[model samples]
Target: MAKIAYILLCHKDPEAIIQQAEQLTAAGDFMSIHFDASAKSESFAMIRDALEDNPNVTFAHKRIKCGWGEWSLVQATLYAIEAAIADFPRATHFYMLSGDCMAVKTAEYAHQFLDDNETDFIESFDFFESDWIKIGMKEERLIYRHFFNERTHKSLFYWAIELQKRLGFKRRIPGDVQVQIGSQWWCLRRRTIESILDFIRSRKDVIRFFRTTWIPDETFFQTLVRHLVPENEIDTRTLTFLMFTDYGMPVTFHNDHYDLLLSQDFLFARKISPDAKTLKARLGKLYSSRGIDFQISNEGRSLYKFLATQGRAGRRFGMRFWETESSLGRERELMIVVCKKWHVAKRLTDQIRQETEIPAIDFIFDEDNTALPDLGGIQSSLAKRARHRRSLMRMLFEYFESDRLIVCMDPSNLDLMHDFFSDRSMTRLLRIECDFTDDYLIGHARRIGLAGDRTSQLTLERLLPTIRNDINHEADRIRDAGFSRHFRIRQSDSTETNATKLVEFLSLPYETALKLAQTRQLFDD
Candidate 1:
């Protein structure tokens, strides 16, 4: 039988740790926990008293004050490992876990899996050659001596790094050990663990170098295990399921993640929220159940890879493949109903919707009422609304098979209008220019109370010409960008505007166009 010892590094929430300890030890496994020195003294005392009577549970003798992306994490982990090894001499493997981690499968299954595979499970790859550092400093991490925690003192940390760079100062790796980077979690066989400890004890200079290195916890064990163990004995994958956001923060599992956790084959998953009571309770029950059916499957592993790929290069960043371009409205006929006045645009869109069987929507950026074709949820911010508008245009084609659709927009939103005008392949622009005289605009502003006082009213009055000029300028730009036709409807000649010309430009059937033209309210000022 395989006996596994767990080393848990925790900073907060003693009750949660106590619960995890009880569940993990139910299968006759040993647990060694290290509480961060920075955590409240009461939290540490509470956990120690709760588990003091349990023979399988031990606490680290040395506690370190840990900070994000600092060397203290590595020290805390080392203490936990030392305590586990000293107490559980019969243990076959040592698994590193965070307090947030919970068993996704029965402990018996995890022990059997570890026994069957003698190789150490960890993620280790050459740091200098790999593309792991996507967002921040890469080689400088190893070369520069960092004295500050980047998360807590970002400005000072970066300033020190810059100062070192300008002075041509650099640190050297103490030994011939190759630098490897990976996730901090790992499951190591006893021999491998012993080898890593022996190496650490013998190398004082190595400790000095990594003491100030950025995020050494993730790198220290990874780099040493490669040097100490044979290549074939090391598996460059963690047994724990973990994921990070685009911002490089860990994705915490919550109460709703019960099904999500059940589907994973990994023995444990980490960064569970403290408030995930339901998820922890259910998984905890399943953890110690003797007859719980647990089968090893690749589905969860496959899902992790799929989600990671999508997160890095998906539509969130506006990335799309050429093969799918035609499906995103590249080949479909699109009509843009452009106008500055909200009421006029809404009325025209309603008239078109009444006249045609095809989908016609209006005012995606409307202040009071946003119109979506197949999507819902009114965005509250201007930036979000603009992004949704863009998504609406792209996704609309995939949802509908109609030959044409009408999208009414207010060009007053220059941010959205300019983006629409840049693409000119299959889109037609129908512009409505309201010819408001100076007297009419001034009187209208006053009647609507556009501003409070005389000076403010005068400012609103002066803004009228600028708005008209911007609309006219955009029309010229759109025409120059190769949009085939521009149908301008003015208040003076609204009735005389040729209906047939408008119908041809929009690629609408004559009957539908006739009905649309007959709706005199569409052209009414």
Candidate 2:
């Protein structure tokens, strides 16, 4: 039989967390703890001091700023589990318990139960099952990003998280990883725990995907365990007894519920608060149990207390990918011009100032620009490439407050264009059009031709139709999606006035529009 490693993730109820630590230490089991980084500093220190005598215990070096239902909560749990693996080399079974959880069964019996059975204990189920889901629910969590709301301070994101779920912005869960949801508490074998850690450390796509998701804790581990661990080797039952209540906190157990805890055949029971004195007073006298002179507060599953918990831990994960220099803030009407590369959309913005009083912000996504990183090879360094796009997404979030966003794509970079508008609300978009063969090559050649030297470029015969076909396909897709503002601009000798065409395309509401007196002729200086 292998030694057991007890991993505890503690945020509140310092005394209870430490008491649980001491009991496991006394049981000759290795114990590890990770305190929430955002918790009151002194309380965390006090808990450490109280548990100073326990040699079997180890604390995680780094603390995570954990939030309820967000990915950070899951991050803290991962850190603790990783720390436990480093602390105990010989331990084979790993048990995860909350700060309020107490071992009701004898240490000998509990160890025997784990040692005798080859089963891995975990509680999980398909989240999309009808009973768990409401009728006519929108896309499942995997498809859409669930987010937290600011005003009401609840996870009101049946919509997108601060990071949109649409392509280019959000990370996708691996196709191999199935959807699983269950009780947040569970136990895993050493290998199972290691497999999960591997997933966390190397799985950038999954981590970045859940970073903005709501209550990712429920699915993060459940999906990993179910996908990696074989069904025969795992036990689907939860080892602890839980009581859900209307309030955020679980119902405390008194002497009256002692039999009920034992009757459930559960090894652990929750909630040893000061109010549960009758039940805890007796359990405190047992060997390996230490004195609890300090009273620690327990902030339980607060989402239940809607208004109360909303005020606490309301901050979701901040945008992580990119940084910005613009000063655009709330309550201002701003326009965004996201071009394919440096000044690719310059012509589009020429008459914009003549048309609108509101200022416009420009963000260029072209990889050639100094602002963005290179879009490197597919396999060499995926982490860097993923971060590259993530930086772009962060840039998108910055300009998200725009009243109307105009995404301008060029023939050279149509692949990167679709992602710009996918995650954004269609209502916020004023127009999405591609400009092909818009004097880019000829104009640039003209500027450099003044220096009396120029490099050879592709012939118009080879470039024109290819760009035309690509822009046509892109335009068709956006129009089919019901965006009436989608159009294409390809200027030629017989083509209509470029400026006048744009003026009508945008449908700008300006008092005095700047109309070009005479459209320039092609190849004119």
Q: What is the C-alpha lDDT of each candidate?
A: 0.73, 0.55
Error of 1 at 156 (Å): 1.4
Q: Candidate 2 residues 69-115, lDDT tens each?
A: 56777877877787788878888888877777777666666667788
Clashes within 3 Å, all models in order: 0, 1
Model 2 earns a TM-score of 0.51
In model 1, what are the clashing residue pairs, if there are any? none
Q: Over all chains combined, what TM-score does candidate 1 have?
A: 0.59
Best by lDDT: 1
RMSD of each: 18.4, 19.4
